[model samples]
Target chain A: MTGSPPAPASLPGDDLLNRIRALRDSPAATDTGLGRELGAVADPLLLHEAGRLLKGVAAARLTRAPATRATTLRVAVAATFTADDVVPLLRAALLAGGVDAELHLCPYDQLGVQLTDPASALAEFAPEVTLCLMDAGALLPRDWDPSALDGVRTAVRDRVDAHTAAAAGFAARTGSAVLLHTVPLPRPDRRSVISFRGGAALGRIWREANIALLAAGETRDGVYTVDLEALFADEPGPVRDERQYRFGRMAWTPAAQLAYAREAAAFCRAVSGLGRKVLVLDLDNTLWGGVLGDDGPAGIELGTVYPGDCYTDLQRRALALRRQGVLLAVCSKNERALVEETLAGHPDMVLRPDDFVAVVADWQRKDLHVAALAEELALGLDAFVFADDSPFECGMVAGSLPQVDVVALDGDPACHSTRLLEPARFAQLGVTATDAERTALYRGRRERHRLSTTHETAEEYLRALGIHVTVGPADAYTLPRLVQLEQRTNQFNMTGRAHGEALTRRLAGDPGHLVLAVEVTDRFGGEGVVGGVWLDRGPDRWTVRNLVLSCRVLGRGVERAVLQYVADTARAAGAAVLEARFRPTARNAPAATLYPSAGLTRAEGPAGDDETVRHEARLDRLPTLTPDWITLVAKEAPAHV
Target chain B: MSDTMTTLRPLVARVSHHPAESLAPDTRFTALGSWGSLAAMRLLAAVEQTYGVQLDLRAYMKLETVGELASEISTRLSGGAETHAG
Candidate 1:
């Protein structure tokens, strides 16, 4: 198998048939490959047919070899009915979501025994997660009538408690996480109660029973419950088909299976700690209706109107995710200044610049920038998910960073939010707010950017905001962040070397090397330790090893003040010249112009090798000074040799 | 092949992993050792979904030949209710 095949233009006629046949013929037929193809089919009947074809190949593959990948998860599924067909569907879903699960399925109606008994084969299998699937018809007694409401209530309570106790007991005994779902009440059962009043009472009892199921999961440590009825309510669908249920023992329809399979995959990933922590969005057709460069701010479709309302809904969804503590960021291919101006002043935009943790809006490979973001946030690449409307960009990011989950949005902005969140890619159970301060910082949005229209110049706005900065020597407290800046900073980093804690300490503590930590605070909030400066205090000329600042503090004058402080300290320490090196990276073009903007003269002749350009300013001349708008606090005295 | 047979052969072939040409009107679904209940139900589902008719389990159990399933589907498609069971 060519792992995951390139998605076809359209998936109905010869194209879809050929893909199914090709995947069926391949020797490396995996559940992931089959599921990926299954995602393309839209119609329910066609989806089932394609799923069957692809699942046939995967079933044969499943029997041949056991999964040995590090991504392989050990899962045990115990369902009440004949769920032989369910095994393949779950396998496809889990594998496509990048989990190779070694599934252990119990015999029919063996859910309780398989869960509770230590001597059982399920115990022998010793799964990491046990999924307990249920059916309401199977739980309720066959002879029971809905006429006696009290008898109905008693039977429901006993059955529901028994099922939950078995699942919770299994979790306690085996230490494997258990996943259960709210059983959708059969429509026939509801319609059995002829009177409207009786039907409502029956519905209320079933709902309370399902709530008990959910509440039971909340009390237990290793058990999780998903509300299938809630899901069925949100999504339009029939819960069951009488013929299928009676004949095939499949209580749920294809729609129910598809929905449950998706949520199950997300639950398995979330409990395994593989859920995404960051959602990287594209700007052009994703955030708005058109391209920012091609269609100017006013020209874009992003207000409260026909097509633009779709984009606005998506922004609201992203804002909701951020409120739940999932950090939002942008990795787009557009001009940074244009993006900033739009993000700051676009009245139609629901998401402001303050919403994003990092905005990498320059023309760089999105994969590289996403990786940089993961490093800057001190997280793993697996914790990030990238969503884009362009298939080209999605393919690139998916190819380069296979760990990151890719949500490919299509032409319809209406479906974008649903596609992005339906998988519950960023959903988690309990979010411990480890950084309460960070959460508080993001609580209130700074409306000053929206007020930029009133200010005559950008400087006047800056002056009104009252920005403050403190540049001091790096101590034990700020060394880790400084080292992170050295490793992670790209655009504003003067030197792109792999620096470790040892070198950072030598720069901070040693007399010859000086490391400065720049902290920033504005009228909005406090941004802790946003910039770093590493310098070599030479006899006659001070050399700058690295000057890296967080992109969050860019457009502000914090970086300029840090540079000025380095120059002033070096000159007072008897250095004749302040020299700096500009090393170029694919992402560091913004850094290339910084030296000249600070009034440093570029050395003409050869300026070192192909990569590094030399910039020097005579300490006696001291052409640049910190701007008055950014007030620098007097901290550590300049330590001279 | 009849139009019913044309559609029936392919569906049975897909579920049973046997070629369409291998199926005929007199073929018993259980004649092949590999043909299990699961495959039978899938074929039943495919038929039900394609023809938009429900084949009762009792009627389905009595089915022994591929030709009988076609006649049963035809009976339901002809606006009759469980009339072909006997």
Candidate 2:
């Protein structure tokens, strides 16, 4: 059963101390881990004392099933000494957090012989995850043997090529996701420099693997790369500062342990569904402090106060999500007028109405609101979470909608800052330069939508927007955002899927997969990296399985651009038919009219509505490109991952 | 499944910062407490948001027995009109 008491009334400092004494004497007072974390004396007592200001509701019957799912993912560790030593600690931490794994430890060897053959050990154990703990030493060459360097580089490239083919073959035979961890070895010595710049070697190898697989022509997919540099970047000051996180002699402190745990959780979540999509946010205290109506535009404290300051920081985080090509939406309630006023005119409102790709405001039922937003935006609700200040609301949202993630706020104004800044819930699958401009672009989308509504005819409105879509193979500059969109976008995504940084590398290693990203720009602003498309390239035909669009660019002939891009690319590649499959999901009904409207012939399929529908269209005679609504321009694609 | 959800309405109202009288089985949880991290982390927010209840840490701590908590909440609902969380 669940039981929580409401926060008591706030008292003056002296009264608060007195109340603390009385509560300490009360029969309800009990010692817990939290108290131990604080000193035995008054810190823990202070926490409870602070709780009194924001009263809580007592619930006796609320019982929670602590997460007991055993993490059955076996992991293999390969790296140099420094990183290799950290593996035991990482493994222990994961085990404590419910991960089930048998650590396969390997030492650093010259020319990556162990890595190439690590497959044999991996095959034997059938590990679910592999961690390549690369040390700075692995990156630097000890003795420069020019002939040996050339021989080793060639061998490394060839080995990657051979393994990619085998892995693609293995994936076709067995449906399993393969991930590669690409840790940049700190270049302590200049000798590691080879044909390409040291940093570029990792990038080049990753791409070679992708190209090999793309050329192989097997639909066998399951390869991804990890980017460590970006992960450590953009973190909070205290988290980034090595001194604070050092914790005495250890490089990774207890706080770092918490950070790593949070990273693992994010990694699991991003890859939870077929791919990562959907980001949910809390409104009120999270987006801004105080109720919209009660505080009014001027009264609702934001930007600088202790509580409001925290909310502002959270808004900045949300903005960062958008810049990475993530789709943003709101599950908040307020007087529509007040919220509008605050978002529009308030100087302190960091997050304007434009930041959200979609929003559910007003007193409507939150579950219904989320469902409607999912439908309108054409996204899956499974990735949705309702963030709100009230526990009652979080509880209702969680109970009524089991699939959605709900984040409840503790009302203590003091702890409000760090509490909201918890990295466990807000981590993104990938980060990119495009991620920084997301909030502003989303605002532009909202403006376009509003303007689209003002037009008498929806189709005419779309045509007038002059949307231009650039679609092409994934290349270096676009690869970061492409992976990010795959991880963050939810609505309008046919197959919600997320891949790792190594996705480009794997794609480049094989010839079978055709990976493409879409960039849409209308008169309003450049909605960069609006969508992503992944398909299997066949000698005689092309089959697209995953196609997702940014909710911001929906209803503006963007889907048409996707079909047109695939058709053109397939034709150029000597494919006759471009087969598009529509998988019915709770949120993707918006795409039901797609194949038919695009003039594709729908063949009879296994009859259930949820069953995948197969559609085929000949490349020779395709629908005319509507230049006014959408102009499909091909951009310089990035080298495969 | 039906009974599991049946007792949920009252539990939600009891645990919620909102009024028990107005809150329905399907009412939103944000009407009461401010949307903050304390509640989200405590509840894990994925399964229990709709029920307006969190994983009772206080109960897990042995501060109060389950029966004592239920009786306390019942007494509060039945008589006390103050804005105490029970």
- Please provide, for model 1 over A1-641, each residue's C-alpha lDDT reduced to its tens digit, 9 standing for 90 to 100: 12432332222333454566776788685433444555444444444444455543433343222221223467888888766666656665665555667778899888888887889999999877788889886566776687887788888888888888888777767667788889988877777899888888888889878998898777665678998888877655477767677766877666577677767877766655456667899999889998899989888888788789999999999888877667888889999999999999999999998788778888888888988777556556766889998888998988877667789988678888889886677766544332224433432222444445588999998898788899888766566567655544656788665344445665677788888878788787776777888888889989887899876567777778888888878877889998888888766776787888887888765645787778998887776667889998846735531
Q: Which ten residues in a row have the lowest lDDT in candidate 2 chain A?
A: A57-66
Give, for candidate 2 chain B, the lowest lDDT window spanning 10 residues.
B39-48
Q: Interface Cα RMSD for candidate 2?
A: 14.8
Tens-place lDDT per residue, model 2, A1-641, is 23432222232233433443454455464322221121122221122222332122111101121122222344555443323323434433332222333556554432244434446554455544444433323433445343344554565456555544544443332223443333332332223455555536555644454454344323233544444334544443222212211222222222332334334434543443322234666567767777766766776767787777877777776666555555677767777666666677889867667667766667887778777666654455554545677888777877776555556665765455455434344444445677677556656755775786689998788777888898888776676676656555555666443444455446535689877878888888898887888788899889877788876677677888788878888898899988777776555666678778888888765523556778888889787644456777887655444
| Model 1 CA deviation exceeding 4 Å by range | A1-35, A41-71, A233-237, A247-249, A291-299, A374-380, A399-403, A435-641, B80-86
* Candidate 2: Cα lDDT at A220: 32
Error of 2 at A57 (Å): 33
List where candidate 2 sits over 4 angstroms from the true fold.
Answer: A1-114, A123-129, A132-262, A271-372, A383-385, A444-467, A486-515, A522-526, A532-563, A566-630, A634-641, B1-86
What's the TM-score of each model vs. the native? 0.64, 0.49
Report the lDDT of model 2 for residue A381: 57
State in Å the error of residue A202, model 2.
28
lDDT against the true structure, each candidate:
0.73, 0.52
Query: Candidate 1, residues B1-86: lDDT per residue as tens digits?
Result: 45566567666766665655677778888885568877777677668767777778788878998878888888788877654330
